[model samples]
Structure formats: C-alpha cells, structure tokens
Target: MNVTLRQLRAFVALVRTGSFTAASRHLHVTQSALSGLIKELEHGLDVQLVERSTRRVQLSEIGEAFYPWAAKMLEDLDSALRAIADIKELQTGVVRIAAPQLMACTLLPDMVTAFTRQHGAIKVRLVDCAVEEVLDSVQRGEVDFGIGPERALTAETTARPLFDLPFVAIFPPDHPLARLNRVTWKDALAYPMISLRGEYTRRLSADLQAVHPELMLEPVHEVAFMTTAISMVKAGQGITTALPYGLSIIEQGQLEARVLDGPRISRRFHIFARKNRVLSPAAAGFCDFLVQACLKQDWVRLPEAVSR
Candidate 1:
C-alpha cells in the first residue's frame, strides 16, 4: 500500500529485536513512536504483525513469513540507494558475474581479489557454471557478463574476443613428450589421451585432423569438465590437451604441462554481455578488470622465449 521506508525500517527493527523497547533502543526512537509505527503498518496491511502480552512479543504467522522478505526488500532498497550515492561520489554499484566453471576456478578468484582490494565498496558475486549455462544465464540477464569459449550469442546478447587460449598438453614429468619443449600435433595423437567430451573437444579433434586429414582420435574417456580431464591426465591415466589456464591449474601443484606443437590450436575466450542488460557500477568495474587481467596474463604467458 502506501507504507513508507521509515515505517518499513521500524517494522524490521521490532521484528529483529522481538520487542518494542529493544527496537526503540536500537532505532534511537521512543518506545511510543516504534509502537505507533507498528500500528500504522497493521492498519495499512490490515493484519496483526506483533502479538503483545505482558511478558514478551511474538510475530504472528503472517509476520514471520513477511519479515525476511521485508528485510530483503529494505536491504535491496538500501543497496540501490547506496549505489546511486556512490555514483555521485565516483563509486560503482555491485556487479554479479557468472563465469565458465574452469575459468572461474583458475582465473576469476584472482580477478575478484584484486578488484576488491582496489575498490573496497564495489560488490562482486561470481557464479561458476559450464559454457552453455553461462550463456543462458547472461541471456536471461541473470549475470552481467561471462568469460569462456564464446558460443554463438543469441540475438539479444553481444560478445567479443577477449583473448586466445592455446591448447597445451599435460603429461607426467617423465613422459616422452615431457623432454620436448613442443611436440607436433601428430606426435600428440600417437599417445593415449583423456579429453573434454564437448564441442571444444570436437574442435580440438578437427584441428588435429586439419594437420593430419587421415588421422582420427578417440579419447580414453570423455568428461564434462576441463579440470576433470586435466586431473585424469595428471593421475597418469593418459596425456591430454586443454586451454592454457587448464595448464596453469596444473602449476597449482596438482598437475604439469607443456606447449603442444600443432597448427596453433586454441579457442577464443570472449567477453559476453546481454545486449540490453543493465549493469551496476560494481559489475562494470569487474568487467573492465577481467579484460585487463586476461590481457596481462596473455602478455605473460605468450610462449616463453626459451620454448619458442
């Protein structure tokens, strides 16, 4: 109805504190004022929110269900107001991102960390899922943007190449390919392998076939995740190839890798946002940070001079 923010705030205070006196203390209002606000809210909503007996106060069933939602409404309202205030003060609002799972695991944590350290007030929520899921979420305006292999963006979405991720091979330290700085595509095919069981994997196989048109590769097993495929290779199940950071994940001490010599097989890691999505200031800050971070890593990881 016509309930005001102040009234809602007062109701939340009493609901949280469980008594008018305590709520009055916390709200810095007289007990009578807090009690009056509750009465006004009941009149507006035509329901009893608080049950009053001498010993204590309790929320009616409707009040119990309504309190959390009311609190969230107030919280969201406050966040929006604060974000607007920040804009005037040169700060951005929160940014919610849904990133591809493997990239989220290896890359996003660092991006979020550095961004938070730089902009203390900007809020960031990063959700991790597969490429298809990321695309769907962004399309639905559930996230500000996504990073991974760019699938075809829907008409309502926009995407751009952020970077290229070369497919690198991972083998145990003593494996045959380990001694070589780079091994040819045909050389890689000769080894038993584990690989992702998705479009990316098909692309890799096709890329291999480009160099060896007659060649065919059937992995030991197809997996749903890049990390899992990498793990399989590291456990010595067989050798495998993955996006560059898939190799970086190895450096975390659970695996190892080397550049695969081929026709430069790599996937485009792209930045995607819904065509008409409204991004909060915080989200926009994160988007900029992610692009910059990936660019820096690209510079740093461009096949070391020794390997080239």
Candidate 2:
C-alpha cells in the first residue's frame, strides 16, 4: 500500500546477503537503519517477510514469493534509467527530420553524415518530400522537426529561423545569363525560367511583387522538385533560381549560379516543430548540431535581425 523502493531494496539486500550486518554494509547504511527499512516493508504489506535471528536471516513464505518480483522490478528500473542516460549522452537514439527534396539531396545528407560521424551510434532518418509537404509533415507528427523556407504558420506549429539566404540564378555555362558578372532578377526573368511549382513559385512571386511590382516570375516550365529544374537547366531548357545551399546540385548539373541582385530578395528558412510537443534528446541535439553546422558554412548566414 505504501511500499517504498528503499524498503524493497533493503528486503532484497537482506535476502541476498543472508545477514543484517552484511546487508547494511552492502547498502552503505547502519544495521539499525536496514532493520527499520525491512520492518517498514513488512508492516506496509501486512506480512512477515523475514525470519530474523542472531546468526542468520532468511525469507519467510511470502518474502520468498515477493523477492523475485521486487528484484526483477529493480532490475528493469535500472535498465530503463541506463537507456535514458544513453539517450541524454547521444550515445544511442534516432532523430527523424523532414525537408524538401532539394535540401534532402544537397544540404541535409552532408550535415547528417557529419553528425553521425560525431555520434556514431545515433541514426538520423530523413524524409524528403515536396516543398509544401515539409510543414505538413511536422504538423502531422511524422517527424521530430521539419526544415524549409518560411511559410504561413498553422495554429499547431512553431517556427524558428534557421538561416536567411538570397536567391541565385542557375544556368548552363554557355547560357547568356552565365556571362553576366552580376545577374539580377530582371536579367534572369528576361529568359524563359524553370521554377518549382506550388507554394515556392507563389511565394517568390509575392516577394518579387513586394520589391518590384512590374517584375514577375513567369516560368516557361513549372516542376515539383528542384532536381527537375536543374535537369531542365542542364538540357538548356531554361534557367532556374535557387538558394545558395543548392550550389552542389548546380555544380553537379554542370550549371553555374550567380547571386541575384537589383532589389535583392532573401528567404528565411526555419525549423518547424509541433507547438506543444517536446523534442527527444536525439532530436534536440541534432537540431543544435544543424544550427552550428550552418553557422560554419559561408553560404548560410543567420540574419542580424533573426534570433534563435
């Protein structure tokens, strides 16, 4: 009814050592204290648990039956505590993250690789979906957190700025835009643009309208993934726009990227998580590692106005 772990431990220790002096020594407590704990346990259970004498001690009928259960309970509790300690130390656990396909392919893989190298036992599970799906994944509790450009926050989600980066123009080496020392939105818009469809294009258009009302991104082709846009650019179909983090993909596609200027617009990326839920130790550690990793990269800059 009112049994305590201390009482249970004393009972088990006495049974194991078979003597009051040895049990108290093992528990680092005085013999009287150990005797009191055993008495308390038996009193709470309303049963005699120990047959005590001057030379030896042994379990009564009920004590023998309860000893195994108490020992097993303590063993299980110890194992659980050890597991939590391992997670806190980042020695073992899994971190689930969701991001846009481009970032999943370009930025996240390298970051995850670096993190795993440092925390060899932790596993990072990355979910790569469409740009619009990043927030959806977070809202649905499918991931520990989601990373992408800022979006309209829902009531169930919270956003924290990760980094802010200006857009860059991606074009083939031989393209006319590639020759320009400084490419502006106007210059890039002059050509047929290949843009990501859905919220990405909508947001870019809105941002452009806020800066230069007359300039708009009317892409010749609209696709779901940045990889597709890069493929189109590689085929000389059209130039595309991306953040600086996508430089690896651009380079791999045999395309060059120039920073966009002339009313330069930048997008802020954020880490999105469920509003009321707490992140696991592994997830929180991975998030911190990601922030530090971004800070080290020249391409990723935390705006002075933004704070964690």
lDDT of model 2 at position 80: 97
Error of 1 at 120 (Å): 1.5
Residue lDDT tens for model 2, 1-308: 89999998998888899889999999999999999999999999999988875367877889889999999999998899999999999999999999999999999999999999999999999999998899989999999999998889988899988988988888888888766777789999999999998988998899899989999889999999999998988898989988888777655438778878886788889999998999999999999999989988878643211110
List the candidates' TM-scores in order: 0.68, 0.94
Clashes of each: 3, 0
List pairs with backbone clashes in candidate 1. 93-281, 93-282, 95-283
Compared with the true structure, all predictions reach lDDT values of: 0.76, 0.88
Q: What is the per-residue lDDT of model 1 for residues 1-308, given as tens digits with 9 covering 90 to 100?
A: 77877788999998788788899999999999988998898888899888886468788999898899889999999998886888644365567788877878887788788988888777778888876688888887777887768577678888867777666777777788766767776777789888777776777777778787876778888888878877777787888876666454765445556666656666787778887776566666677777778778853358432142
Q: Candidate 2: minimum summed lDDT over ten consecutive residues — where?
A: 299-308
RMSD of 1: 9.9
Candidate 1 residue 147 Cα shift, in angstroms, is: 1.0
